[model samples]
Target: MPGSGRLVDVVDTTTRDGNQSLWGATGLTANEILAIAPTMEQVGFHALDFTSSTHMSVSVRFHREDPWELIRLMRAAMPRTLLNFITTGMRFIAWQPCDEEVMRLAFRCVVRNGIRRFQFAEPANDPSALRRVARMAREEGVEEIVVGLTYSISPVHTHAYYAERVAALADCPDIDRFYLKDPGGLLTTDAVRELGPHFAATGRTVELHSHCTIGLAPLAYMEGLKVGFDVLHTAVGPAGNGTSQPTAESTLRNLAAEGYEHDLDPEALGRVSTYFRELVREKRLPPGEPREYDAAYYHHQLPGGMVTTTQRMLEEIRRPELFDAVLAEVVRVRAEMGYPILVTPVSQLVAYQATRNVIDSERWLNVSDETVRYFLGHYGDFAAPPDPDVADRVLSLPKVGKLREAEPIGLEGVRARFGRRISDEELLLRLTMPEEQVDAMRAEPAIAERSVPVDAGDRAPLVRLLREIERRRQISYLRVQKGDDLVVWRRAS
Candidate 1:
C-alpha cells in the first residue's frame, strides 16, 4: 500500500455525535445501533465513541432503552476497539452538579459496562473540577482519558487561552490525549493555521474533533494534519458531512495526499455507509450531506445539533419565520449575559433565552428558569460577567432567591429520596431526574416503529453495488466518479 510514513488514527463518531446532529439526540434506537456495530468494527477505526450521560438519559427518557445494555452490546461487538463515553466531569450529565459519591458510583457503572475510554470536557475551562473526576475514571479502570478543550469564539477564548489550558493538562497523569473539540463547527482555517502548531508544540498526542456545521471542518482538518495532529475524529459518509464531521472517504483521500498513513479499511467503511444510506432511505430518515458555508453561523454559533432543535421549537410555535430572528437574538443574549462557551447546556440555555426575547412583547419579561439559574452561577463560571443592567434585572427576579434557598441533593439525600436498596444505575438516573420519569422509562417499551417504510428505488443501487464489491476480494481500490461526485474505497490486501 502506498502511504505517508506518519500514521494517523481515525476515530469515528457516527453513532454518538451523528445522533446529536441528525436525530435531535435520541433518534436512533438501541436495536438500530446494535445492528451496525459489527460493520463499524470491521472498518478498523482506532476507537468508536458510543454514548454520553446525555445520550444515556435520552435513551431512557425517549427510547425506553436501557443505556447500560447499549454499552454492553457495543462492547461485545467491538471487543478489539476502545469503547468511549463523553462526560462533563463530576456533573454526571445533569445540568447541575452532583455529589462526589454519586459521580464515583456512575464511573464504576460505566467501567463495569465495558466503556474503556472517557472524554472529559468542562465548558468553563476549569481543570480543577476535571481533575477530581479524571482520577476517578482512571481509578475505575478506564484505559484512555481524552480531555476536550471545547472551541468557541469570545474575548476570553483567544488562541493563547486555549494553549495555556492544553499545557496545564500535561501535569494530569490520567490524561492520555487532548481533543480540540469544535462542537459549534466555528473553527476557521486561519485560526487553525496558528492554533494547530501551538497545540502540536504541547508535546502531547492531540486529536482534532470538529463538526461540519459551517462546512470548514474539512479545511480545518487538513490544516491540523499539516501541523502535526495525531488523530482526526470523523464519521462515515451517509452519517457524516452536514452537521457531523467530514466524511471519512474524503478525509482519507486528503490525508493520503498529505503523506499520512491510516489503518482504516475504506472498502469496509463504504459498506458501513451503504448500510446507513439504505437504512435512512427505508426509514425515510434524513441522510446527512455536506452543506455550503453560512457566514451568519459565526454570530449565532448554534451547533448543527442545536440548529435542528431550534428549528423544531420554532415550528411548534408557528413562528418558523422568526428562526433567523432568534439566531440574531442569540448574539445579543450571549453578549448581554456573560460570553459563555457555547456547548451543550450553555448553548441550550442561550437559545432558550433568545427564543423568549424574540417571542415575548417585552424583552427579558419571560426568561427561562435555567437562564435565571445561570445568572445565579449554578452552571459553573463564565468567561465574562453579565452586563450590569442585565445582572441587576436577573438578580432581582424572585426565582433567583428561591433557587438560592433550595439545597442541592447529595448521595445520602438521593438514597433517602429513592431508597438505598436500588441499584446504582437506577439511583444515578433518579438522582439526575425525578423518580417518576425513571419509573416511566422502566414501564415503556424498548423501541419505537420507524417513521416510514424504505423506498425500493432509494436502496437498490447502493445495495447492488455493495454486493458486487463483496464478490471481488482481489480488488484493492475502487474509484467511481459521476458528474462532480466522487467516491473512493480501499480494501485490505
Candidate 2:
C-alpha cells in the first residue's frame, strides 16, 4: 500500500547470481552473453548484477575467456546500463586475505574495466571493514558503492544488531546505498516488515536481493516493496526461480498488480527470457523452477549452492543417506562457530565441518586448514563468541602458529612472482590462480564468433553435430548419408 505510486527499480542478476545458482556459474560463455547483451540493454534494468571476482576467475578457469574482455565488450554493448561488480571486501579471487595494496589494485582494475557499480559484503558484517572497502571503491573511481547488510537468522543477528550496523554506516560518504542481501533465502515477510524500516531510516537507497531457494523471496519482495525497498533483484526465464532470484516476468506482474511502476519493457523482457530458455534447452542445462516450501532448509540455513555441493559430495562418497544428518550437523556447527552468514567461504567452511562430523566418529576430528584459520580470527571477528570448548580445541592445534605468522602476499611480491611485463589483468589472475591454469587459459583459442547454435526443432541433433564439426577447426569438410538422401558441406577455405 505504501508503494502505490512508486517506480521500483530492478537489477537483473541473470548473468551472475542466476548462473551460479542454477548452473554452477559456468552456464554462459562470453559469446553467449554478448549475443544477448543488446537485448538485455533494452530491458531498462537499474543495473546488471553482472560479475563478481569469483565469476571472473571462473571465466578464466572454465571458459578460458578473458574476463576483462567480457566486461569491456558488455560495456560497449550495453552502455546505458550499469554493470555491477560484487566482492567479499576481504579478498580478491583467492580465498586468503590480500594486503590493502592488492585490494586497491583489484578495485582499480575492476573499475577501469567498466564496472560502474560496486557492491560488497564483509562476511562477518564488520562495520569498519565495510567502511574501509567503500572508501577503497570510491577512491578507485567507482560511481556507485552499495554495502550489503547480509541477512542471517541467529540470536546475535537481531534488529538491534543490524540497526547498529546501519547507524555506523550512516556517516560514510562513500557508500551510496544499502543492499539487504538474503543469500540464504531465509528472509520471511515478517522479517522484511521488521528489518525494512531500519534500512529505510538510513536515508540511503535500499535494494532487496534474495533467493527463491525456499519459496520465500517472492513474498519477501512484495513486503520489501511495501516497506520502502526501492529496487528488487530478479532474473529472467531459466535463470530465475528455484535457487535463483524471482523471475523478472512474475515480479513485474506482481509489481503491476500492486500499482507500482517500473521502466522495464515487457517485450524486451520476453525476448531476453526466450533467449535464456532456448539456451537452457540447447545446453541441456537445468532450468530454474519454482521451489516448494521446506522448513528444514531454514534450520540448516545453507545457501543454495552449498546445499547442492554438499549433496554432490555425499553422493560421491557413497554416503547419500547421510545427507539429512549432514544438514542437521550444519546447524550445530554453525552455532559452535558463531552463526556466520551462509555465503562464500564461510558457508563452505561450515558445510565442510558438518560433512566431516557426519562422516567421522568425532565432530572436530578432521578440521580443515581454512576452518582453523577462521577460528583463529583470520576471516574477521565472529558475530558472537564461538563455543568455548570448540574454540579452545581449534586454537590448540599445532598448525595455528604457522597460520598466524602467514602474511597476505603483497601486490609488489605478486607482480615480481608473476612477470612485470604482463598487463594488470593477467597479473591479477596469475596472483590468485595456479600458473598452469593461467597457462591453459592463454593456450586456448579466443572466442571470435557467436557459438550458440540455433534451435532446429526435430533436426536439432543434426544441427548439434554440425556445430561440433565447426568447433573442430581442423575439420574443413563434412559429409552425411542415410539411405538415398545425402548432404555435404564444405568450408570456404
TM-score of every candidate relative to the true structure: 0.88, 0.92
* Alpha-carbon local distance difference test for all models: 0.80, 0.88
**Which model scores highest in lDDT?**
2
How many Å off is the CA of 289 in candidate 1? 1.9
**lDDT, model 1:** 0.80
lDDT of 2 by residue, 49-162 (tens): 999988998999989988888899889889999999999986888888898988898999988888999988789888899999999899989999999988888898887898
lDDT of candidate 1 over 38-88, digit per residue (tens): 778888988888889889988888777778877887798789889899887
Which residue segments of model 1 deviate by more than 4 Å? 1-3, 444-493
RMSD of each: 9.2, 3.5
What TM-score should be assigned to candidate 1?
0.88
